[model samples]
Target: MSATARVLVDGLGVDTVCALDRGLSYGDGLFETIRFVAGLAPLWSRHMERLQHSCVRLQLPMPDAALLLHEARSVVGGMDQAVVRMTLTRGVGERGYALPTTAHPTRIVAAFAAPAMMGDAYIHGIRLRWCETRLAIQPSLAGMKHLNRLEQVLARAEWSDPSVADGLMRDTDGNVIAATMANLFAVVDGVLVTPSVERSGVAGVARAEVLASRAAVHVGDISREDLLRADEVFLSSSVRGILPVQAVDDTVYVPGPVTRALQRHWRGLGFPMEQA
Candidate 1:
């Protein structure tokens, strides 16, 4: 694990960002948390596609995908395992809501040590809390990996217990959105039911993979009652992959056969399944 984070700003080696940057001021940006093993991000194309879509939606200049990938590799060096965070922010702008005519987006790519989770988490599953911080319904920002994460930050702050893996979040309409840092999925009967990010939450890469798989998957609305009544519950992310949820608030669920099957599939895809 690297003790220091390697960072590149605008394709150049830099560690500092301007205070006037729109991302810092108004969270006008998009970011992706990626997992790299053997100096390669397995879902590089997906991340790029999402980033491009975000750029178009936000009217920010899109960074060169090839250049960004090259810089990402340079930051990773020869690290066997690492987590790369890519932040693309609308460059320095004056204090106002008005759009800046001269927008030079800043691309900050950094690599840090991949987090080590306890192996027991994958086996026994982890507990989750029900966050009171409800996500606002903003269809324009829905499903994009934008940098406005105050909602997630507040939800994560609701719990301090290290035993708690994450917190399940909901929209203002009381519809289940996802976990604070991952996408939520529940196995009902033999089908996988996940919340649609059309109104809130992120469209996770791991969640995308699961939806694309041959498994019986359904994307639609999910309520808190539905989650509690499900046979199995799990969270998916690019870095964390599929994490079985043993409990959410008072509801308890053991990692069922379906959760185990997905875990095996992830491991087969060359992800490091072993908990640190």
Candidate 2:
């Protein structure tokens, strides 16, 4: 079958390709969706680190970062709000699981308009449901945001209510991991606690900053009961930054002291904050 993709490759430049590349074939690839402001990415280094980590795990070669940055800048076209997506595949290969020595890696960089900052996500906070899809125990791939996201997709599909903003996931042993796309944090007993990404969940770039910068905060296994008793809860993501959790199950929170302060620090970190 003929390919329809128009993304660029490291050595081949821009070319027409099929969608049924090995990436689509066996989820044999990795990708990053980065939000750019005024065609600039403050967190490009973080994204590059994660992307390189993923490439190493998948045995996919890292593309020339200098060249990739040029492509990313070119695609935005001076848009104030932009979302640059970078995808790397092991290129086309034979119909098998073994890595092909002859196959070259495919590179793609595209830009789009950014999504609205859930103003309410910062102030009024968000609602969450418990997901039934449990993340698998794979430490080698645990913290990397690989393309194999069927677990998250299935968990997200469990809810259709627009009111349910996101879903909290767990590992196979029922230990809390993170939200479908974002990381989760809770303040129990005035201590900020989040799930340790051991068996599942992508360790978000934003998550690392929060843990390192916040006081008396660290990673741990937080249960539903722990959240119910916590003073506040919030979500974090590379694009979304920090968001308060107003309601979880039948419980409600006033967004707590730590969560609010973190929101302020997060804004100083360069992400947009809720309008006061």
Model 2 per-residue lDDT tens digits across residues 33-124? 88677677877888888888878888889987888888888777667777777888888898889999876877877666776765877888
Error (Å) of candidate 2 at residue 230 is 1.4
Best of the candidates, TM-score: 1
- What lDDT score goes with residue 216 in model 2? 71
Q: After superposing candidate 1 on the true structure, give the runs of residues whose Cα lies further than 4 Å from its correct spot.
A: 1-3
Error of 1 at 250 (Å): 2.5
- TM-score of every model versus the real structure: 0.96, 0.90
Clashes of each: 0, 2
Q: TM-score of predicted model 2? A: 0.90
Error of 1 at 94 (Å): 3.1
Weakest ten-residue segment in model 1 by summed lDDT: 267-276
